[model samples]
Each structure stands twice: as structure tokens, then as C-alpha cells.
Target chain A: MELQQLDRYAKALIKEAGRKIRHSLTYELVIESKADANDLVTNMDKEIEQFFIEHIRKDYVGHAILGEEGFGDDLLSLNGYVWMLDPIDGTMNFIHQQRNFAISLGIFKDGIGVFGYIYDVMNDELYSAQKGHGAYLNDEPIPVLESTTISKAIIGMNASWVVPNRHIENEGLIRLVKDVRGIRSYGSAALELAYVSTGRIDAYMSMRLSPWDVAGGVVIAEEVGAVATNLKGQPLKFLGQDTFIVARKSLHDSLLANYITLK
Target chain B: MELQQLDRYAKALIKEAGRKIRHSLTYELVIESKADANDLVTNMDKEIEQFFIEHIRKDYVGHAILGEEGFGDDLLSLNGYVWMLDPIDGTMNFIHQQRNFAISLGIFKDGIGVFGYIYDVMNDELYSAQKGHGAYLNDEPIPVLESTTISKAIIGMNASWVVPNRHIENEGLIRLVKDVRGIRSYGSAALELAYVSTGRIDAYMSMRLSPWDVAGGVVIAEEVGAVATNLKGQPLKFLGQDTFIVARKSLHDSLLANYITLK
Candidate 1:
């Protein structure tokens, strides 16, 4: 497989998809309730996802698609070529803030990520990577992260971990929160994972995230020796939302070894 | 009482301060331990705050200054004209991410917020407002929010609220997390408030934030009939951190009346 060509084509397609989403932003778009009325999935999300499916079917007819808007096919295995899509990862931020949203796409063959791209639509930043090659942010090659202790690390975590959530215990999360240098909670998991890949924060954690949410990010993050794994310290399950942590390898081990109560 | 002049000067100063910060990002700078090594107070932060304090003192002498990094005056009461400043509101984001940081300043008199400014340093977008005048995103005037109902609103919240924090009860916050249309946590209070003022998110809820963090944001947010108060719907203290909510007036009232447990 020509990873360069795959990365280039994927990048273009992601940008075009982003443009389509941007066009819909000012069309007095009708937003509909999903999961619940307060939980939104805009017409734009469907439009963008369908757009990707249309193009991929025409070009990569052999591929399977997994998407956030449910516009793609069902798949039992990642045995063939598969493309995971989150047309607008931060849909809420997109609908409300019109910024901080992204177009995330990942290509895998036989369950291994071959090429991944995450485009920050508003700011025009493209973070892309191919297996074994270094990741690039807006065309500049991003280096692997240097080591830092947990005490000196800036940790990215949503406050939900500290509350009475169904996922992790609150006291454990609170202790981690106090032990870290500081904490940040950006609403988008994909972007936060990308941030971790680039060494912005030493770690990124969430109680729930889908495969599409972390697929592209995990591909890029792994190139920098960042561990994108579940709480059990094993590889991610590309099917459902699970408790996940993507961090510099050392930090990830230390966090799992010291904190993180699994009950 | 000349807002344009103050905004003009403030804009320029903010830009200059941001430039100094951007310049620092290019160097092989040392990350020394302040309160904590990872809890950084960079040279850039100190320099930027000093730059603003110097100019404000030279020009707006009668203006009492309250700032982060302790570079300003010792304040007993906020009775006279007060300029609350945070050279870089998301200092952790700056020290670690080099983005998501901003220069936030709010001007108040006799405890009434009069003007507010939040400049996204890397993005170069300045959100500003003067009392009685409509808020503006850069040069475009922002209108008051028109959305109603908790279900239709896009809310900004740190998910940690669901885990376990002391400011607001976990059960109450979890219910809130489920009630909002969506949630976001950008790690920067100033930008999030700017988004709230401009109607990006219908409301914003956080456990504790400093006066400088919300001072500028609340002033701009109120111009559009958005309310800024503690979760209990009480006035905000201009000294320390508190559980705060800033939202469209209707949404704010609904959340406070229907949800949000203070004890």
C-alpha cells in the first residue's frame, strides 16, 4: 500500500468534507434532536457522512464505513479495508461555537491502521500519519514526545471522572486530578487525542468513546510512542465506547499502575 | 468613558502581549518550577502581565489593578474603577499546548462590570464589549441569544462535574449533564464566556473560577440579556473562585429553578 498517496487523498477528502460542513453552518440549517432533544445531531452531520460514503463507495468500493451519524454499514470484523468516520467530532461545539469541530477519518487493513487524518476545520490544521512514519501537523513533521514524570505532566480529563458517573470511581479521579500538574477538558475526544499525540498534554482520558472517535488519533498517537489503550492496558476495541487513556508510554503505565480504580 | 480608545489601546496591548508570548514559543525556553514545575508561571506570563500593568498605571493611574501572577496592586475593596487582568487565562494550555490561551481583561466601576475583552492569542480573534453597547466578535456585532429550553441548548461543562467535586453535588451535576443538548469544556474560561456571550453555547457551568476569569466575560454576556451569577443565582464575588453559571437569561433562570443543587 502506498501510504503517501493514501494520506494525500484522505487529507483532501477530509478538507472537502469540512468545506461542505462549513457551507451548511450559515444556511439557517435545521438542527434535530438525537439520543434526546438536548442531545443534537445536525443535518450537517448526516450530509457530511453521506458525502464521505458516496465518494468512498465510488473509489474504494471494497471498503467498509463506520460513522457517528449511522450513515455507514455494519461490520463484524476489520479483516478488510475499513474507513472509520466522525464527520464532525465536536458536533455540539460546531452547532454552538462554529469552531473546535473536526473531520476525522481513519483507514485500516486487516484491523491495522494504515493511514489517518484529523482536520481542524476552522483553523485548517491537518494532523496526519502513516504506520512507521512520523506524524505531521500542517505539513511539519511532528517529533516523538520527550519523557516527563506524572507530577510535571499536564493531564487532559473531563470533570465527569470526578463526579458520580457510571464509569470510574470519583475519589480515584479526584486524587489523580490533584496529583497532576493541571487538568484540561476540551469537549472533543478526537481533538484531545490529537493534542496528546502532539505532546500538548501528557495524557487524555475519557470514560466513554467510540472506535471512530479514537481511530485516527490512535493511529497518529502510536507513531509517537503514545499508548492509546483501554484501562486494562490492552489494545482498543474498535466497536463500542470504553474507558480509554491515550498518553505518553511512561505516563500511561504510571497512571494505570498507581491511580485508575477499575470497578 | 471613551470605550473605543480603551479598546483600541487594549487591543494593541493584547496583541503586543500575545506577540511576546508567541515569540517565547519559538525559543528553547526553560520550564522552571513555580508552585510546581508542571504548574507553570512562564517568563512570558510574567512579562505580559507586567507590560499591561505598566501601561495601565501610566495611562489609567486611578484604575486599581487586580491580576494573576501577583504583578498588580493589593486590593481591599473594588469600590473605585478596577481593571481585573489575567495576562494569559489558560496558562497551562499555553505552557503545554501553546494554543487555547488568551489575554483576558475586564473593567469595572463601583463593582459594576463596564467593559470586557478576551483575545484568542494564536487565532488572533478579539471578543470585546462595553456596557450598554452590543457585544462584538472582532468587528461584527453579536446579537442576544434567541434559543430557549434546556433540551435545545448547547451547554459548556467540564464532564468532571459528574465524577465527584465539592463545589456542586454530583447527583445534581449528573442530572444536568443528561439534561443539556450537548456539553463542552475548552479549558479556557475567557474564551468559553466569549462563546457564551456570542451565543455559541446556550449556557456555561463550572465549579470554581477567579474574578478575572469571569469579570470580562460576564460584562459582555449581560449586554445580550444573558445572566451571570453563582449557581444559586447570587451575585459573583470579585475576589476569589466560586461555582458560576453564565447563560441566556431564560436558560439561566430555568437551570437554577429546575436543576443545579447548591448544597
Candidate 2:
């Protein structure tokens, strides 16, 4: 299918899924823990992922899906049309605050990102992008990211990275936090990436993240002159969990060279 | 005047000030730094503070004003009716993101808080409280905060406290981050307090904050069964800069007793 056609169909499906999720909030959620207590999953997450799968399977038969919930297909490689979906990113936020969570989706063809969407459900803000077509927040076209120094940049990052963690040295992140103008953490990786795309924050970094957590944001951010990569300044394979950092081109280079010390 | 009468007038004035601020975003902001490059103040900050002062001076003849900008009176004591105002609580967020900032105001009589208001200008969320009449978000009455254990609680705090800062020891904060379910930083103290009042985040802490930053939030949060105090668990005088923390009653005790260790 054409990219624009796919964009429209996917956006409708995502919005429908968002409506379901929002409606579910009126009742109690059936919550469960995944990896740990902090990593939460809800009935809505599974339901939304399943809803997307059913539609995608009926509409686009050959397209595979890699979703956070186990409702989608498992594949070794991204060789065909693959839809990466985090039905509800920031589940803890969804379960706790009922806001700040988003439905994230990224479409890839032959291992390259083709379309990205992150719908902030509660706020009704849709951030999306198609490959080579620029990025957008709702209907407004998002501007490209401009270069900013660390001292003048507002960084979006969780507090976990600066504590003792296995992925990277804590000392470097501590220094980076001090050097930056300010730091903010919204508890949603996809929304943080959208923020970076729109320059609400100059960059967003995480010590570890699954492909589904960042797939949509990476595509949208890259369209606006931002670079998405591992902490080692290498391109993401989008197959598994990896350290993530997305920022403007110059700031990304500076952060990788001076601030980030990988384990 | 009566508390209810003052509440009606203050809400109208705050909403009007918020309208002026919303309109100001269309034009370019004249930004300047205070204390350091990271500490920003814009022309709108001064203008809005002046606007509030002019209205208060004209309408309420004898109210003492303690405003962020120097346009208001500088009184040592909160002897009579005192207005503590932070026209733009998160100036950096206002200048950088065009969101997350708020107009914070607290009215005190004889050094006791009688009324508080925090207006999230862009989002149009107004959180207000009168001493005995309870707290509200817009027209809805906010429920009192329910207790949650540290293991299941989400915390609101800047990453600065976890790094090497002069105000507190970093190790305790690092452990606290690990102990909590999650940590979030919105770069706005007043808004964080509003979030606490609404149970959006269980608690918010800052190593150091001026009275105007916490004045509005403290009143709102306290009315919703949240406790506001310094890191050492002392009451805030709302007279000067001090360490600040606000949380559900039980959580506040646990954080002070087990997590937060002052330098």
C-alpha cells in the first residue's frame, strides 16, 4: 500500500484504539506486573494491541507486527512490512495518572522506518511523520531541530540512568545533568521523543529501552534533523532492547563523545 | 473581606492574567538570565507581575505584595494580608517549551495561608484552595490524597537533587529513585504541587525553593490531605528560600525518615 494511504488507515485505527483505552479508564483496570512491579501492564494494553492486530491482519495480510503485548507475531528479522506497536506506552502513567501515556506505532518496510505515529490520547495531540514527508504535531508541521549547546539545552531523561545502572557509568550522566540547562522526565519515552522532535526538549536519553518503546519516536524525530542511536553512537537494529539516545545532530555528537560512557 | 468573596475575585483576576499570558506567546519573548544562565526571566514575567500588582493595589487597598519581579513591595513580615506571587513559576519552561509554566499566587492573612491559586496558563487548568473550604481543579473538587507505599509510589523531583549539589547528599536521593516506582520532573514547582494535590504524583521534593514557588502549591496540596515541609520535616514559614517537599501524609513521613538526607 502507498505510505499516505497507510498513514490514514493506521491513524484511524490508532485513534479508535485510543478511544477504547480512554473509555476503559471510566472503569477499573486489570493491572499486572511484567518484568517487575514497576513495569506494569493492563488489560487495555493487551486489548488495544489485539485490536490493531486484528485490523492489520485483515487489511494488510502479509504485514508482520512486533507489539509490546504478546498478541502480535514474533519474527527474527524485519524483512517485510512490519508494524511495531506499543499499544500503550507508559503503562504506569496510564494506571497511575490516567494521562501522559500514548499509543505508539511505527511502520517499517525492508527494515527501514516508513511511517511513525505517537498519539497522546488524553491530550488529543497526534504526532506523526512519513518518511521524507516531514513531521507534524496534530495538523501543524513541526520545524526542524536547531543546534544547541549542552549548557543551553533542556534534556528529557528518566532518573534511573543517573543511579547505579548496568548499561552505563553513572558519573558521566551525573555530570551531564549538572551541565545541561534543565532536565525533565514525563515517564513516557514515546512522548519524550515527540517533545524532542518539536524542540520542547533538545534531547532524550535512556539507559535501556526495547525497540517498541522508541520505534515511533525515532522515525518522527529523525525527520526533523534529530539523530537516534545507541549510546555508543551506532545506528539501532530495531530488533531488540538497546541503550537509546535521540538529539539534534550536533548535540548528539557532543553527548556521545564527552558525556556518555557505555559499560 | 470574607474568604469566599476574596476567592471569587482572585479567580477572576488569575484567569484574566492567564489570558494576557496566553496572548503574549504570539510575540517574541525578551528573555534574560538571573543567578545563572539556566535561571531565566522573561519580559512577560515582569509584565504579568506588574499587572497583578496594579490590580491588587487598586482593588484591595492594603494588601502587601511579595512578587518575583521587583515591582512589588518588599516587606519583612507577613503581618497583614500578604500576596505571594510568582507570575511565571517556570520561566525556562515558558521560554523553551511554551508550556509547563504557571501563574502562582497565595494570599496570606497574619502569616497564615487563606487562599492559593496555581493557573496552568497554556493548558488552562486552574488549581485553587481556600483554607477550610477544600481544594479544587477548575470546578471539580479534588479528593484528599490516598496513601501509597514508597515501592508503589511515583515521585516528582528534579534530577539535580540526585547529582552532586550543595543542598543535600546525593546518595540518599539515588537510593530513593531506585526505591520508588518512578520519578518525574516537569521543571515547574507549582505545577508539581498541583499534580500532588490531584494525586497525579504521590509526592514532589526540591532541594531549595523560594517562598513564591511553593506558596500556592502548599495551600492546594495541604487542603487535599498532603503535607508540605522541608526535607528535615519542618514546617515551611513561607518567608524565604528553603528546602521543600510535599506528599501524602504517610509518604512524606517515610521519605523524610528513610529517603531524604539533608547535607
DockQ of each: 0.50, 0.79
- Model 2 ranges with Cα > 4 A deviation: A26-41, B27-41
- Sort candidate 1 into its docking category: medium
Predictions in order: lDDT: 0.81, 0.89
Q: How do all models score by TM-score?
A: 0.88, 0.95
Tens digits of lDDT, candidate 2, B39-117 = 3337778888898999999989999999988788878888999999999999889878888999999999988999999
Candidate 2 clashes between residue pairs 3 or more apart in a chain or in different chains: none
The local lDDT score (0 to 100) that residue A112 gets in candidate 2 is 96
Instruction: Chain A TM-score per model, please list them.
Output: 0.92, 0.94
Tens-place lDDT per residue, model 1, A69-129, is: 8989888888888999999898767766777778888888889998878888888888988
Query: Quick one: best TM-score, which candidate?
Result: 2
Provide the lowest-lDDT 10-residue window in model 2 chain A: A32-41
lDDT of residue A111 for candidate 1: 94
In model 1, which runs have C-alpha deviations exceeding 4 angstroms?
A26-41, A167-171, A237-243, A261-263, B27-41, B152-170, B237-243, B257-263
